[model samples]
Target chain A: MSDHQPSQKELPEAPSTAPTPAGISRRGFLKGAGITAAGTALLEGVQGFSREAVASTPKGVKEFGPEPFPVTLHINGKEHALQIEPRTTLADALRIQLNMTGTKVSCDRGVCSSCTVLLDRMPVNSCMTLAIDAVGHHVTTIEGISTDEQMHPLQAAFVRHDAMQCGFCTPGMVMSCVSLLEKNPHPTEADVRYAVSGNLCRCGTYPKVFAATLDAASQLARKA
Target chain B: MNSFTLADCSTVEAALSQLKDGAIVKAGGVDLLDRMKNGTDTPTRLVNIRNISTLRGIHSTPQGLTIGALTTLAEVADDPTIRTQYTLLADACGHAATPHIRNMATLGGNLLQQLQCWYYRSAEFQCLRKGKELCFAFSGLNQYHAIMDYGGCPSVAPSSGAVALLALDASVELTSAAKGKRIVTIRDFYLQPDANPHRFHVMAADELLTAIHIPKPAPGTRSAYQKYGEKESHDWAIADAGILLEMDSNLCRRAVVAMGAASPVVRRSHEAEAALTGKPITHETARAAGQASMTGAMPLSMNAYKVQLFPVAIYRTILLAAGQMDRDPSAAG
Candidate 1:
């Protein structure tokens, strides 16, 4: 499974390494030298940071690849046992297996926050996160937005301010907003914008999103 | 791209042991996996270390803040210790990538984060740094590459957090099962792509960034980190400045100036630091410091804009660190 375009390194010899002092570490160079450079370039154009490991080239699509290991995802205050292929994302486990589809998945690239979830109370793009690595952490998805019988103030404001259209980007936006508020309960408009820049809504509800966040801050402050 | 194995280690020491040879440690995977997704790294076996308790967190000691290898950027930015002791650091962390990215991107990962060059990202482009036939960015879309490369590789070091930490003079704890343990300065942890663009660090495959130690700021000191980008929301700096300055009777006794995305790593402008140190942090001194920072920029065709942008950033950042805007310079001394 290698891309054969050979744009980067036209290696006369396979890249290899042995232990050496003051030399390059010989590992983590995936070669699918056959994938068109255009495909990789397209993916790079629209992206954000993620912790998911990616192969340099696309592995053939296979149905139900056998589980690599049994990892537990602690999502929304519950531990779900999952036998996942190494490639299974934390967001997929949340939506597909746990049936808590509150965290939306679009673009599937790390760039879009549609799959944003809180890993140990911090926001991360879940589509790019592997389930195995999340085994021992607290992950709060959009499903985890409500606490007890009450919705988080941010959620209330998001709905009150009409912060969604198709609702796909809402979960990630809300999660990002809530994470920001967890630390900076009173964020400037600029802060709100910066916090949710990773998330995108085709509906372009950003102004409303910012308004909802500001509204949430005021309400949280009042409650305090 | 799909040929890889994921191996998990519960302890840093355990992760160090997983390496037979040619194994790369996966921390938060924010940077490494992004590179992999973009065709930069293809590992046969990845030794996972994010779950290692010893490798995450920020703790204060008499020496100063000790950031674990897996300590998330969010933790660094939000930690009260960092906020109080290292304001510039807090500011830089606050501005890193985005809030979502800050969650999983570790401090170690951020400093170790490789260059984000477009040519390097492409699987098809040939660049001189990847031992390629040519460096596309030399004449291509290098507006975001580097401004300095007197050496070999000319890719910009895509590290905002490192710029802040470099100002703080942080040190790294490198531990490998075979090499035991050793500490390296943050300045030493990074390399210019010209030196070797294929890998970012000299730390061994069996090694783990056990911890990063930042010494307490010097007495009577102030620091600031300011960056210029297309926009402040979630963008890499067009030009960035991190300054750690020590003052004596309102005179600039010393300063450390580091500029990022202008070089392979957060580059310290000793010339700039020397020009401002022990001076009265005057507008003239600040202007000279900025000039010093911008000097020695060997910008490629696409990034001359940074040469202009960085000088202004450095001047502004130094003044901010010197508390120039808020004070009467005549009364400051």
Candidate 2:
């Protein structure tokens, strides 16, 4: 995927009558409104919380937002510094702030693995993690799984096996498989199934996911 | 989720000092973030305790094992010593949520998680557990509600770690800035519905769960955990059992049977434990123990199936712990 922000013209227009708050751009408001053509962000938007500062605590505890604070996130082996609210989740920070939109946020809650990302090489739901909490940690998104020139072996295997149907779950599924193969280079069918168990595919492409993950394991083993 | 100040604390003292009214301690932020997102809890500040290195390991002493509260479920589930000795806790942690969740969720977060009732979880309903007047589960969709020991609330206990810890006779260390520290058994850790429907546990707003202490299981102890969910992956246990049996060859000398997703809180079945304490490990005895477990269980309207499920869960889990039978093929979930 290209590292470019989608233009305002590119976004589907669901002209909202609701008042857009200041400091939040129209594109940000529309995106936060969760208007998607493919019915992707149907459940909850990445920035679902109210942005208005309600209350403030004492100053001695080293507090950061109710207002935008300086936060430097190390995503995909690169450092990107941005000012974001403390309530902004890692998923929203990646998609809305840094425009690393490869990490999708279908269900902003932690139940769905659509926002799966690697924090210090461990797969976790980025939607549940605060962007500030990700400081001093190595964050890897689906875009960072492979080099610019080539796809990861797991990604290649997914393409070879046609592992996705609706394709919404492909990124998260690939990230989970990549995490599994990194830990266990040779995974069985059950192992692969368990690895991607959290990543739900509404189209039910689980069999292909299992097959692709195992195939990638063998391919990596051969390379080794 | 509301906008809150983030206090990133590196030391336990710093985390403890930051704790105040309306300030929440965040270990892994798995359950806390879920509660905040659901509008169940709105904290003015999140005291980040994840950076406290001293609160993130498992240590063994001469008497027992101590597990730091910040230790992830994945670490507890994969620990070699826990796998061999505390098999019940290992199995419970291993089968929780998912691989990704196990990697991110902490022991303290799972143990302190709120009920899984849809009414309480959703912001739309003002259920009794949330200090409201009515419990919608009493009249609404309650196919997965509690079938036993539900008073005013049919919401079931949702923690697998609590169930296993109760069976293992574990104690939790709660530390506070003002009150210092106090240790309480896992059985006494939870507050029953009758005690207080508003709060799940007795921990104060200013306190933090520091560590878990599990006394060494007696010699000849065998244990196992069995959980039955509607789905095999990433679902809470519909009915779960954790059994610890101290056996002398084939005769059961002592037993601790704790159940989850069956009651408002993870509870030990004294009747079931009494039935198995002196009996020989056999299918018939296991069935009798299972029967004893459901002595006073009163099911709600749609959850009568749980009445049938709990006994079978207890029966098969007992057999599993005693090495009398393999895992029931039909109860894979």
Candidate 3:
């Protein structure tokens, strides 16, 4: 292949520990080059370089391809191993890899809370979190919140109050509400609003969602 | 999203080493991931610094408050000391983003968040901040652009933490292998768009923001933050003010008033602070201070609404900080 050609070629196969013309090993070159090239390319547009020029671009840099790597995720109380690219978000890993579709992915840019899930018991946008980053963290999706036999109080209240319209944002809303209730058992209406502010229900289920969350909070308080 | 390698750094040293080796750092991954997906940023290797234990807590000392950079926004909003002693900071953090975002976004990440200008965030527009010759917001849809003229890029700084820190006079501790450690005041931390349109703050690529130092305020110091948005929740501020005042009886001894979203950088209105100092914070003085805060403000075609809203936000923050306003600022409007 021509050095300046921008063809989508596979990464050259070589020993991971074998050093290139530069002192750094092939693995080190791949790691460093992928990062440096991307970082610089973000500010300065990507440049066309020959293969030799790319290899000799820096001492410890080499380009990377879209290859999958082994990743172990601790979802709820279970551990699941999957092969995914670095671009795969925790939400995709849960929904696609593990088949835990309870966590939705609306506005995957972290604006909407449809992908909200508990990471170490704290509500986070699963779509914005990388699966590799959640390696050791405990992840709890809406499916984990309720067992096969019994539904969580928040889930039950969501159904009782008819909090959802199209039911698209229900899982995320439930996750956020449950997280809030866990932290503050007696949250005010304003608190509920603030807790789920990230979630957007196009069906205009605000009033119903707030009602269900308040009812669930009261029920949990009574149980305690 | 562009494919990248993940470098899980176990310690601060390890993270710094990766950074030195040209790896971009990821903490909460909230803004970074979004930017990556949008093609605004394409970091190939992300050095996960979330595991750096030393950068993860809020500590109070006799001198002041030391907040670790990795401390999540949720922790900052919920911490008792931050809530009571530095209500402005707490309120700013709480009002920023959403519950899920707050749980993930770290203080350091929040401070370095890029401008939220639609044109800038979008990949199609190669604005001045994106190394283009001209800014699209300069003539295109500019309803949400900066009102205050900072020259060059017109996007406003999108950090609520920066506004609060400016009001509180906080300093950030930046550490790098080459420079060791140094402190930069919040005022000096941010650069004007005219000076460096591409860069947001003065933080170097190899340096890490380890912590923020907020000096203990004088006795009887009261602070508050008030922002005006279209929605009551989950909306960026059209105009916002963070005020810190040292009250002696009814008169103000010292005042620091910082405004955000109205300007390209978190700006402290010295004129507004001067209007309130040594004077009783009555309705008339507060109103004057509000008007004074917008001195020399030059708004764009669509952002003139920010000029009107800035005064209201400033006035409301002053009233709340002085204990004159008892209700939430949002309710006041």
| lDDT by residue (tens digit), candidate 2, B1-333 | 766667778777778877775678888898889889988888867898887889999999887899999899999999999999999999899889988899989999899988889999898998888787899998999999888888889889999999999999899999998989999999898988988888889888878999999999999999999899887778898888899999998899999989988899999999999989988978988898898998888988898888888889999999999988887665533
CAPRI class assigned to model 3:
acceptable
Positional deviation of B229 in candidate 3, in angstroms? 1.2
Error of 1 at A9 (Å): 52
Who is ahead in TM-score, 1 or 3?
3
Off by over 4 Å in 3: A1-66, B327-333
TM-score of each: 0.80, 0.90, 0.87
Q: Encode model 3's per-residue lDDT on B221-265: one tens digit a residue.
A: 999987778876666788888999999988899999998887788
| lDDT measured at residue B136 in model 1 versus the true structure, 0 to 100 | 70
Q: What is the C-alpha local distance difference test score of each model?
A: 0.73, 0.84, 0.81
How many angstroms is residue B180 displaced in model 3 relative to the true structure, after the best TM-score fit? Answer: 0.4
Clashing pairs in 3: A3-A50, A29-A62, A33-A61, A33-A62
Q: Arrange candidates by TM-score, highest first: which order?
A: 2, 3, 1
Best by lDDT: 2
How would you class the docking of model 2?
acceptable
lDDT score at residue B323, model 1, on the 0-100 scale: 73
Model 3 residue A113 lDDT score: 88
The runs of at least 3 residues in candidate 1 whose Cα sits more than 4 Å from the true structure, single-residue gaps closed, are A1-66, A96-100, A107-109, A146-156, A165-167, A180-191, A201-204, A216-224, B1-4, B326-333
